[model samples]
Target chain A: MDLRVRELIKKIRTDKNITFLLALVAVGVFVAQIVYYVQKGEVFSLKRGFQALFLSVTLFLLFAVLQRITKTGKPFDKTIVTLLRVMAVVVIVGGVLPSCVEVFVVVIRGGIYTIDIANLDIFVPVLGVMIGIFSEIFSYGNDLQEDNDMIA
Target chain B: MAIIVRLDRMMADRKISLNELAERVGMSNVNLSNLKTGKMKGIRFETLDSICDVLDCQPGDILEHQ
Candidate 1:
């Protein structure tokens, strides 16, 4: 009930809408990616992998926003942290795997397989998941502080 | 954490029935009873402030750290 803490809580709730929207938009983007590719053959390097990363990161961001909104002051769950790890694996497979394959195909079709990594789509879901995981840990730190205060 | 809520006391002081408070607060009498008995873990600040204002007391008047 400290005045400063109370004020911070109020501010957090007010700002939560933005974070929630960001998360929703990210999820929407991922959904669209899948839908577009499946329906229109508009494939990303690795649609599933990219989405898996994007969804993971945004989900983490959502958790961070929820903590602020709820005034719970901590990451509410560990499962989300685990999700970050899963996302990283998916990202590597999604973006890098495709480019690697393309290079291999080019080499098999002709001379030296050029190290053409410039075409790698790095801004996909995997990177998003990393951001999400970081946010969760940041939110968790707040929770840990609250827990300590309560325990004391 | 044993915060004894004295809602029943305020009701008695004001000579208001539990049913009346429940009706005024737009809550079930049973739910109100649970809140009064500290069976609830959380209460919205809006509800808490409203109840205190109507009962003409501070939250501590209705609830206390036991």
Candidate 2:
């Protein structure tokens, strides 16, 4: 391999390690928030708790995906594609489930539930779908890389 | 796999070691070994040219269709 390419790969590995560490720290912070809420005997909204849990899980998955990419030294790996797809699904679910839970809670409390169109946040699920699309693109790139490797 | 690599036969006929051919062809031993064993999916024109130059043979002498 050329020295430049080796240097670039090393730089990318270092960047990924930093990102992974940051993600781990973010997960720890979220978990600590949940613990603090539990210890305070606060009536933590179930929706809020679930959102925190989902966010933490997503961050941890990001950490794992970054670690895997660093280890393989290939961003277009099949496993990374799969992990990104899973992350996309999780993000969509995380975005939508809180709203569903809010509606359920309102209905159970005997309050007339109204659709707040202005408050509906569509960006999160859209971001998830975009990630899914990117994963598909990465899958195609992985196939091309495999083909290139097979040739002399 | 209708097209087959006959690199092993060519190398044997020329009495060339894999390491020597790889060095002369400017390719790694593992890649040259893969070519010799017919494990490669395809060959680049440049690589084929180099191998031919090293072996003093034509492309047909290193490849065959069955």
Candidate 3:
């Protein structure tokens, strides 16, 4: 490989390592949050806990995809595509589920439910859709990469 | 799938080892090996040109439609 290409790969590897470490830190934070809630004898908010867990999972999946890229020196792989798609779905569900649970709880308690437009988080699901689009583009790029490889 | 590569036969007739042909053709041994075994999906015109040049043969000598 050219020196520039090797250098770029090395840089990518370093970045991936940093992201992996950050993901580990996020997982640690999630654990710490659980421990704190247990020690306080307080009911853990399911929505908050689920959101934290999903964030950790999404980060871990991102790390996995980066690790695959570092290993193969290519970003367009089937495994990476699948991981990205899963992450997108996780983000979308995680973002929307809290509001859903809130509404469900209020209805169970016999309270009038109204959609709070001001409190609605539209960004997270939008980000998820953006990730889904990126995964699709990567799938196409993967096909081109395979064709290039076959051409020697 | 109907397209076949006969690189091995051409290399044999040309009395050229894979390593030598790969070096002369500016390609890696693994890629050349893949080409020889018909494991590749397709070949580039540039690569085919190099292989033909190195083997002193025509494209038909290395490719067949089965």
Q: Tell me the tens digit of each residue's lDDT in model 2 across A16-95.
A: 67766766665666567667656763333555666766776677677777777657767778898888899999989988
Encode model 3's per-residue lDDT on A45-112: one tens digit a residue: 54455567778788888888888877777889999999999999988987888667657766776887
Pairs with steric clashes in candidate 3: none
Our tally of clashes for model 3 stands at: 0
Show model 2 residue runs off by greater than 4 Å: A2-5, A32-48, A109-113
For candidate 2, the lDDT comes to 0.81
Ranking by DockQ: 2, 3, 1
Interface RMSD of 1: 9.1
Rank order (by TM-score, best first): 2, 3, 1
- For model 3, the superposed segments whose C-alpha errors exceed 4 Å read A1-5, A32-47, A101-114, B1-4, B64-66
Candidate 2, position B40, lDDT: 93
- Separately for all candidates shown, the number of backbone clashes (residues 3 or more apart, or on different chains) is 6, 0, 0
C-alpha lDDT score of every prediction, in listed order? 0.62, 0.81, 0.82
Model 2: lDDT of residue A22:
67
Best by DockQ: 2
Better of 1 and 2 by DockQ: 2
- State the DockQ of every prediction: 0.04, 0.93, 0.79
Question: Candidate 1 at residue A69, lDDT?
Answer: 43
